[model samples]
Target: WSSSLGGVRLINAYGPTETVITATCYDVPRDETLPDRFRGVPIGTANANRLLYVLDRHLNPLPPGLPGELCIGGENLAMGYHKRPDEEKKVFVPDPFRPQGRLYRTGDKVRMHGNGLIEFLGRVDQQVKIRGFRIEPGEVENILAGHPHLETALVAVKTDAHGEKQLVGYFRPRAGSRPEISEIRAFMQKQLPPYMIPAAFIELDTIPLLPGGKVNRRALPVPEDLRGQLSAEYVAPRTETEEELAAIVSSVLRIEKVGVYDNFFELGGHSMLGTQVMSQIQEKFGVEVPLRVLFENPTVDGIAAAITEALTQSIDEEELAGLLGDVTDLNDDDLNALLNDE
Candidate 1:
């Protein structure tokens, strides 16, 4: 767009109202061609007389590429908010670098590049802690939007039925292209860690937008069930052990059904939930499955096999054979009844 404006220099300016408008400005290069994975344009250097500091929670400066809160100090800084002293005290803090000077905490997460340009990561308020990892939804949204089949992508934290927070991806497919949930999951898996991958991908024809053109997060529909959005196909339990394990997983994750090959973490299972699963496994299977085992195996079939191995080690071959025979002879109702009895 800047290239089309023959002689005009397009500058991207960033600032909050508290900073008296523009604090930092970036000169957009006329011949710039954005890369496929471009996260965002740099906010550039501080304006004249203004100081930009990318600082950690302690107001200590962060090294390049390390994300932290953006704090502004120096000349252009506002005195304070009008009659909002309590709020002012929260955001406007005394500058450790400059005695008697105040820095406005922008509440914006950013990282400085080696070139001294600042890259806006996202708002600090938008960051969510999931599975003990601090994640910026914009990071996932940026990667998900890079998928060939997606037109746009948005990620938000939604609490699942298990009272656990889970990442849910909402996306609009490119014109005339319908992307499979499994394909989207695969695309994200390659670029993200297991915990970062969304538990569900919901297709949207158009992402709801507010009058001001921002995404209407409150209007986004909640997914009824996440099982259909998983990367794995629905593979029913083939054995009594698998059936029991699947039931436990389904109940814990609050999903309708869990396939034998379905991943536990992919279904929003975290370390905290893994402990609960281990407790249930010991109670129901009469064998101790460590929390690490669930993380390592992370599948109904794998956990069932682990349980079988644990049980086998505790008993003789003849006893194991008899137990297997007894389980194989039971129907679904009888098995459920037996498990309930246990």
Candidate 2:
């Protein structure tokens, strides 16, 4: 697009309010193709009299290609926030790299390219921990943006009715496209591991944006119910085992209904919750079920089948134990006769 402007130069500027204006600038090259790994345009190197440092949580400098919190130092930084001492202390701190300067933590996650250009990953606060896995929503959003049916996508961590944190994907479908939640879910499954997948996907006509054109996360509607997010259509439990298994899954997930084909992980089930489900199954069925059984067969029907098999094995073991006990009590002549019969 810049090529059409003739002598015009397109510049990408990046800075936080605390930086007292633009701290970095990138002269976007015309007709330049960015590598596939870069999620967005590079914010470029620091401007004159400005210092940019990408550091980890411990204030240690991170190597290039590693995402970390962006800290701005040197003459461009503000003198902390007014009348907000507590908040100021958290973000503005002494620079570890310099002897006489302070760095304002931008709370922006970014990584430096090998060529020294800085690429913005996302906001540090947007990173979330779900099911023991720390996830950057921007990473998932980047993958979602590649889907042919989606025009744009945003992922955020939302608390469900049960007070559990879940990743919910909000997306706008491409023009003239009405993509199903199941199709989106399948696309995500192919690109990401189970833990990285969003628990629910909501279709939005237009994602709310602030005046600056950034996503207005607070404006995104809370899903009234998550049943619509399931990849499979709701099918009520038909068998006694299915009914029991469905009850367990519903209780664990804090969702009202579970279907025979509904996947456990897709319904927000994780390793911790899977353990609880397995424990309850063992107590109810009086048989041991391995943890991997849930991962292999996450649906209610699949779990019910595992439980049924476990129960059958238990019964068979008991019958074998009884036969052994009878043999133990047999006299020497009877034992010999039994051996001969066998």
Candidate 3:
């Protein structure tokens, strides 16, 4: 409200150097609409005698509410930059709908929300399809930056041994602050949709930068281990129960090398996932770990110890004969579900 003390109001505007200056404007004249937040703030409707287009890959116009590359056109458009004809040719493509006219591809993905107001999603190049989900790395980065101890975040894709694409996140903590991978993951799991959550996180002293001060993405190191979450220290599973729990957790969570000390809840476990874990533990070990046990013993070491203690008391070998029937090739989840039912 301190900003309103001055008679002059602030206006949100958008344009590129190619447009010389502002070409679009957004004004929130109402006091009630004083503050507005955008995923990436929408550059409002076009300015006087300006044209904007949200188009598909083929340069065909897209319907409202659909995200596509933004194209700019109008009399306000400037000619090609000096000694930059090659770069200009790439963006200044021929507009099919407008005879002999050209449109500047902005490389920005945006959607029309309501009326003619367009909301910026992210850069078109930043959008990647993961498991059929169109993921904006900036969206994931935004969630990571929301972490209490984080100073900044970056999300990018990497392929593993089999050439499967995976989302990996890199982060830097605030000065003199240390945060665990589980803590950051828990924060992200709560904030972002599951598909958008990075499968792995890597902490960095600093994000690699190019000579021009842009991110040198090509320089990001490929993690050899490919663990779901990278920890500063390596702790292995000790007991057989711990090992099984580690394997099950890693498989179920799509993470790699879960240690005995890792907390399930911190590793993106919710109530539904807790139920599956309980059932799987029951089937695999032929032991019934009550659902409440998960909350009490959330860590691998604690949960494995509790499972061992339970098996020691309820060693019903005769009942196990029938319950363990034909489990030769059953998957972990199915086997656990079957055993839990018995």
Candidate-wise lDDT, in order: 0.86, 0.88, 0.75
Top TM-score prediction, candidate number: 2
lDDT of 2 by residue, 1-342 (tens): 575788798899999899978989999898888898776788999999998889999999999999899999998888888999999999999998889889999999899988989998888887778878989988888888878888888888788777878888899988899988888888888889889988888888788989999889988877777676776888999999999989999998887789999989878888899999999998888888999999999999889999999999889999999999998999999999988999
**How do all the candidates rank in terms of lDDT, highest first?**
2, 1, 3
Clashing pairs in 2: none
* TM of each candidate vs. truth: 0.82, 0.86, 0.56
Quantify how close model 1 is to the true structure by its C-alpha RMSD in Å. 10.1
Against the true structure, candidate 2 has what lDDT? 0.88
Per-residue alpha-carbon lDDT of model 3 for 1-342, expressed as tens digits?
436565566567977777657867877453544223344445788898778898998998888888898788878777876899999988888877788777888887777765888876668888788666778887677667657688877778887555656687888899988998778877886777666777678888978999999888778766555444633245798777788888887776666677776666545454567788888888799888887777787778888889888876776765676566757668999889987999
**Clash pairs, model 1 backbone:** none
Global fold similarity of model 2 (TM-score): 0.86
The window of 10 residues in a row where model 1 has the poorest summed lDDT is 31-40
lDDT of 1 by residue, 1-342 (tens): 654678887888999998989999999887876543346788889998888999998898999889899999888878888999999999999989988988999999888888788888788888889888888898898788878888888998887655777788999988989988888888888888778888788898788999999999878877777666666788999999999999998898777889998988777787777888889999998889878788788899899999999998878867888999999999999999999999
